[model samples]
Target chain A: MMTTVKQAEKFAAKTLTEDGLIDFFSGIGLIAIGYFWLIDNSALSAIMPLAIVNFWKISRKRISEPRIGKVTLARGKKGNVRAGRTILIIVSLTLAVGVILWLKGGAGDVQGTWYYPLFAAGPSLFIATITFFSAIYLKCPRFFGYAGWIIAAAGITIWLGEGPARALMISGVPFLVVGLWTFAKFLSAHPKADQ
Target chain B: MALKPEALDKVIHEPARLLIMTHLYVVTDADFVYLKRATGMTAGNLSTHLTKLEGAGFVKITKSFQGKKPKTTCKLTAKGRKAFEEYRKNILEVLKT
Candidate 1:
């Protein structure tokens, strides 16, 4: 009985990814970043992740929930999520402070130049970290696969001296392909439920 | 000790309703579509079980509109939660005996 209950809860949690919208949006975000980077638009690339977060939320309400329904898991299950968010906040603030200090320490106006190495390897590593915790928090192992692919892409790009754009585009392809296929399959399997 | 067969809450003893309560027990709330899928009940079957649970005051069902479409959400009421806990304890004791 206990095991069955746990299984039911797990099934509910699994709904987060079953529709494949997150992967789909994540792919679009990364590809957008790649395109934005290629065109020398750092600001737009930077905002892609945030934009995709909103898109994912909206898409879930519009697309996924209508089909599979909405199940908001218990708050007690979000301990890991709280920890993840705390760590993210700390890391982001630390990086912000470090950048400020770097500028103050006579590294003036080095937005794109002094940070070249960071740029080349940072997005992949950062996203890898985020997706890693996201996997744990969301109870979705596929995110671990995403994290691994991102890190591998980062390593390859850094070793080959390839730009971030190419690595991002490469990393985004699998998610896009998988997400599209999964979403299509999900739609077919779970049509809009009767109200 | 004699087994207290009467200790089990009859309202939740039904397998389908048991599954529904367990699912709602773990979550704050869930929609009709979600519950239907989680319980693998046919639309009419799930609706029947949910109505029974709702009538027993063990579950609260709210019908509202999400846009033009109808949406039904269910949550375990306080009475429902306590009854579920009580039911679990009784079942555990029975198993122990």
Candidate 2:
């Protein structure tokens, strides 16, 4: 029936809806950025995976999987190709820029002048790009909003010297709040599987 | 474009099964619960349709246990995908004629 297409589209949209996982991960990452200001930057990197794994375990056990059941979408070939292209572009650009800077002997000066801002912007840009691509690939428009938030946060950090901590929190808090809210709604929307 | 009644797939022509197939077409695999929620179909109704689809080789049903809970996941077979495409073409041809 013609209605089948509508129903299928609705199902696709539901699958893409935010359930708070993004918020949880990005929230912890932001909090880690705050810690980065006080401790070694490497510490934050180490904490990220552990934090994410723990959050995933908790969410699966307590929230999402128990309610809606675990749905693992197959990453189609197109998705893989897009991801591969994005990675290749980023790696190529980084290498080309590094080589140019090295040849010009401008690397040291640029790092000295713009280290903090560049450092902050790098991750922010990476997150924004991923979010943008995900929005397009998943047909989830909300990710575009998150991408905007990351860009804005990065812009603010660049404007304010010694603003990495604040920038991280600025971008991170919204994701955390939205994620938690979405999780709560998800819980209410889907009753316990046993029920 | 002349309409050919035989070109239509009777297996997929049924409404409930059509819905099930459409949902399966988008994702790689989905559990019974997820399909039930998406289709707004009763468990008995969905199970019956799934059995039919499975019998026709249009769907592959996998049964496994997660922490003692039985998990039933359904996937559209390559045959099913090709059949659905053909069905769509047949329907469009009918409409155009």
Tens-digit lDDT track of model 1 for B25-65: 98889999998888888989999999999999999999999
The deviation in Å at residue A54 for candidate 1 is 3.4
Q: After superposition, how far is residue A162 of candidate 2 from its true place, in Å?
A: 2.4
Cα deviation in Å at residue B16, candidate 2?
A: 0.4
What are the clashing pairs of model 2? none
By DockQ, who's the top model here? 1
Enumerate the candidates' DockQ scores in order. Answer: 0.64, 0.51
Q: What lDDT does each candidate get?
A: 0.84, 0.72
Docking class of 1: medium
Taking the candidates one at a time, how many backbone clashes does each contain? 0, 0
Over A5-36, each residue of candidate 2 has an lDDT whose tens digit, in order, gives 54565555456455667566767776676567
